[model samples]
Target: MILRQHGPQLLHHIKILKLKKNLDEHLNNLLTSPWVPENTFQFPARGKRNLRFQSQRQTLESLSDSLDIETSSKALSFLKSTLTSEFVVSLCLLANILQSTISVYKILQSPYCDLKSAVEHTEDSVDHFGNIQRTMDVKFSKIFITAKALMSQVCEEIHFPRVAPHQHYRSNYSTKDPESYLRISVAIPIQDDLINQLKCRFSDRKDLLGTLQCFIPASTTETVDAEPLK
Candidate 1:
């Protein structure tokens, strides 16, 4: 599953490509700094969302940037189109996770990253992602609270059908409110998925990496298939 950077890459789901495109276009308008200041907010060089492992690792590294004119303008326009506090918060959260994942991913890419280092990085990433429901509650704490309040209203309205939806909401609760749309209480399948992928990809490479160690040291004998000269 782990291929070289230039090897064949899969196509990304349409949703991912759209999310990245919109995110790239509006980097200037979005306030990603309070959440993640390290990101440069540059678009991935490859247009396809299903990035190669190397590409994904790189894109995660620069998922946000300080606002520039064009990016800012696009962000502003985007904000105007979808103005909602919850939506904004979710965007901030997305950037945050991406930034954290970038650190681990870079470690995995290092030429010196041996099986030991790879396992450590993968474990750290898995810990950060938090597959346990309660831990997720902590990671997405602020958003979790907001999402809960939103979900409550949604369940009451959908099942009961007697409760009237908010009439004066600036954002539409009747259709898809961010509060209801993004559920923080449940395990985040996306984060869990990435963690699983990392484990499955790297766990089997121990023997190969160990053998490479011999080749790395200059003092080590080069393979002499034939006997040495007398």
Candidate 2:
């Protein structure tokens, strides 16, 4: 959920409206170009071939690097200056979160792992991201909005565990355009998808492994009507 869907999706939100293309057509009569060396920003992709998702964090990091260079340049035009510091900071923090997801993915990839442990990791990761969303709301105002929007979208994609409203628990999400209602936390969906996927892949095999472990072969098998032969 984190690497492919939520993480990548979140990175795209942070990059939205920030990366402009065909600057030559938009800006006119600019003296020196605002383009920086590609080496200053771009990173190699780590996605599998033919995969649905690509390297989101890597792309964000590259975009961020480009903006930072442009922001500090005195000769740059309004295009470069338009990339605000707040946006850059939020993208960086989000990229940091993505880096942490690699460890959890590694745990799932290992051979002979416990289902319970995988669920625990999912639970912990969900809770951790929930707390992170809250923290971002407090620390980084710009990030809070983007983070909430990302969570809202991720929740829609991960429609599992069936969130039900109650007295103590209630969903704080709205499907409005400008993201007026931004209180959705996708921790449950993320964890639910993980646990369900794990079970679907491993649960049935558990019974078979148990039977195999406890099996014993007999030296000589008797027929339905046993006969004592010399």
- What would the TM-scores of all predictions be? 0.37, 0.27
lDDT of 2 by residue, 1-230 (tens): 55776886677656554554423322332322323575222221322210111122223333554545665243244323323332333343445455567677668666766755666676667676656545543534444444444433323221212334543464435344322222134333433454466456655666565565456344332347658797
TM-score of model 2 relative to the true fold? 0.27
lDDT of 1 at 40: 30
Model 2, position 103, has a per-residue lDDT of 72
RMSD of each: 19.1, 19.3
Best by lDDT: 1
Model 2: residues with Cα > 4 Å off, grouped in runs? 1-90, 141-230
